[model samples]
Target: MVEAAAPAASVVETVAETEPPATASAPAVVASPAPSAPAPVARPAAVEKPVKPKPEARLYRSRTLGQWIKRVVLLAVGAIAAAAILILAARGVTTLPGVPEFLERYPGEYHLPATAEPGFPWWAQWTHFLNFFLIVLIIRSGYQVRTQQKPPAFWTPKRGGKKISINLWLHQSLDILWLANGLIFVVLLFASGHWMRIVPTSWEVFPNALSALLQYMTLDWPVENGWVNYNSLQQLMYFLVVFIAAPLAAITGVRMSEFWPKNAKTLNRIYPVEAARALHFPTMLFFVLFILIHVFLVFSTGALRNLNHMFGGTDVVNWVGFWLFAAAIAITAAAWYAARPIVLAPIAKLFGQVSSR
Candidate 1:
């Protein structure tokens, strides 16, 4: 029994020696990642530049009073120079071959028909005065209507239509009276057989007119016997004023006026308002030219005689006609001065309503 126990002990010891001794392994090492650089700071987006506004455009440049004066002086100088040149050239042309003979042949006039009466009648004289008054007022009001951007007073028709400036109302009113006067003059002219005086009856008038024009250019005016007969040029001018220009002015004025049918699209298209506007201004300019030329000729040729014929119904050159003319001028000047808003407003109120706007 003791020998078996000893062997068991030995076996146990041998097993313990064969087994490896218990040991602690070193702690596992882990490399931490290096600290990353701070993320780059984001830059602010580039700021956009602000845009500038555009400027308003102008139609006409402003002119000083001095500049306007300078312009007028320049125009006057140019006109004087042109007139001098024209006069010299015309005088030279008279010395050309056959010119004298031509002048002699035409003589700037032709005899009127036997039916045409001589001398100005009382009705004719009165009509002439009426024409003068009405035309002056018409021209003034027309110009005012054209240029007045801000009217002092406006007129609305009693029957209700588009409102017009007081100036325009005056212009239209004057136009009506002038038209009636013109119609009366025409009727009288025909009834008295005076149409033959202005209306050309011969083809020879053209050559005679040319001769008269040349004579006028040469500063050697044609013979004046307007009481009995007018030169070919005067006859032609009178005819144009009485027939062509007057009718044209009336037609264009009516086209532009409120009297025109607003809804008549076909007529509107056929005769556009734009066309009427264009023609109307030109006609007014023509009338103005005619007036200036007529006045100049009347005064330059024989002031007293012409004034007597038209104003006094006499062929004699006397102060009576001159005084009458002076009175007519005074009346015209008064009428012109009184054509303001203060005077026109009450008159407008009689026909319609007047307003500031």
Candidate 2:
């Protein structure tokens, strides 16, 4: 009976089942590489400044070559140009065969022939004016040489191209003007203290300048900061030109004029008229040589800019003195250049070379 009941329970057992799944699933994701950093931004070009190199040694050369021939040609051309300027300035060209007959009527004293007329653009006020005034004054003062007839030291053709009297009025007037201008300028120079800036601050200016000159001769040094800077050699040269030549010009000028009769007599005691004449001749030659050398240096350095300093303006003189002249030159752009306050000028003060006004 127990076996029959267990078998009957198993016979009714049953279980439920599910159906199959549908479509395929999507592919697995893989990440893309990270973007690279941006390329570096390019830099702009820098400002370029011209640099001048130092000078070196030189070897000797002869004058017989084609270079000499070229030099001579240039010299001749310059001479011709100078002569033409002189001729044009004069009413016309007239050469005396010897001293003109009018010379005898005037005095036994000799007169060096004048090179050019008294006035012109380049030879204006300072150079030509002073010269003419001095010459005329001397001639007038020396009108009576041996006797009451003063020896006209300056040569100007009288009635018939005879060396004659000086124009005392014109001469003195110009002299006073010159003295005033000179005194005022000297004062300005001191007050402005521009001279201090120009005076050689160091001894190195000399030898270094000579080295620079030598380099310039060999083209070893190129233009730097504009013009070739002055070395000690240039310092000495300029000092001599300003202090020596200028003073000499003034002294000789006064000696010839009637301004200081006592001084003239004093000078005459030291040197007779003929000796003075000799001195004058040599001095004139020196001046001529100075001008030539000066022009050469100007061109070699930079012409227009150097010339510009002559005037207070920029158009004529582009170079604005040499690089070494930085302390000296003052033009319109000075304030802009210095990054200074724009105001009416008091030059040396800006440089701290002079006290404030």
Candidate 3:
């Protein structure tokens, strides 16, 4: 029994020696990665404001009302003073050696037969009004054109060569109308036997006209018998206005027009443009003078009667002629004021391109 127990103990000891022994483990220690910076936030752009445009400038600013009034008053005073001075001087001059004899020798004559002729006819009245209207417009526009630095528009024909200013175009147009009217008046005057009233039939008219001038200068106004026969002075003046000034104005205007060939050196030399320009201005002045004197005489002699004779075709004094004359004057005033670039540009555009600077 002792030997079997010893063998069992020996087998247990051998198994223990062959097997590995176990041991205790510590907790693992690991560090985490650092946090990265937050991403940058984006900003919006700044806003901007808009800008405005500037206005265009003008060439010449017009004079004020006060300025014009002052000028007119000064002009009237100066004119009166000058005329008085001249007459006084002339009186003193007449006392000198040969002046008295010369004046006496040239002192004119006056003769008028008794006749009550029909005054201005209806056609004559209308034409006269038209002439006045056109002349006023022409003068006003001409002054504007002369003063203008830049043309508001230009006219280029389909068959184009040189371009013309809108104002010049208007001037030419008015001239054409005036010429046509004058032609018609001439025809009618001759056909209706009215030419005899203006045309000088006798050499004595010259002396008669000179006498009338002397009478006028002396302020002893001769009797006016226009219903039957115009004074020799009146006849001469009418003849000059109708035949001489009218044709001269037309000729000069044409010479300075675009229709005049610039290349025609020979023609230009014979009838120079400079000469035309000079004559044209003087002719316009003459017309203006005639109009002023004519108006003064008519009003001074007899307002209603003269107006009736020219406008109403009657010798009787009435308000009809005055009213018509007033209306005509009003229309002329309106036209004169309305002839600015703003009003004329559109009309000018009908013919060609109208561009403003």
Instruction: Write out the backbone clash pairs for model 1.
Output: none
Which residue runs of candidate 1 sit more than 4 Å off their true CA positions?
A: 1-62
Candidate number of the best TM-score: 1
Give the Å shift of residue 161 in candidate 2: 22
1-357 in candidate 1: lDDT tens per residue?
Answer: 988799899999999899975556855568899999999999999999887776544433367666777989999999999988998999999899999999999999998888788998888888889999999999998988887778888999999999998999999999999999999999999998888889999998999999999999989999899999999999999999999999999999999898999999999999999998999999999999999999999999999999998888889978888899999999999999999999989999999999997
Clashing residue pairs for model 3: 108-211
Clashes of 3: 1
Task: Give the Cα error of residue 220 in candidate 3, in Å.
Answer: 1.8
What Cα-based lDDT does every candidate model obtain?
0.91, 0.44, 0.78
TM-score of candidate 1 to 2 decimals: 0.81
Question: Residue by residue across 1-357, what tens digits does model 3's lDDT show?
Answer: 998799899998999889754435644547688898998888687676666665544323476566777888999999999888867765566578985575566444334333324467777888888899998888876776777788876766545556777787788878888888888889988888777778877787887786677566656566775766777888899999999999999999899888888888899899999999999989988999999999999888788888887778888878988988899999999988887778877776776666543
- For model 3, give the RMSD to the true fold: 15.1
Better by TM-score, candidate 3 or 2: 3
TM-scores for all predictions = 0.81, 0.38, 0.72
Count the clashes in each prediction. Answer: 0, 21, 1
Model 1 score (lDDT): 0.91
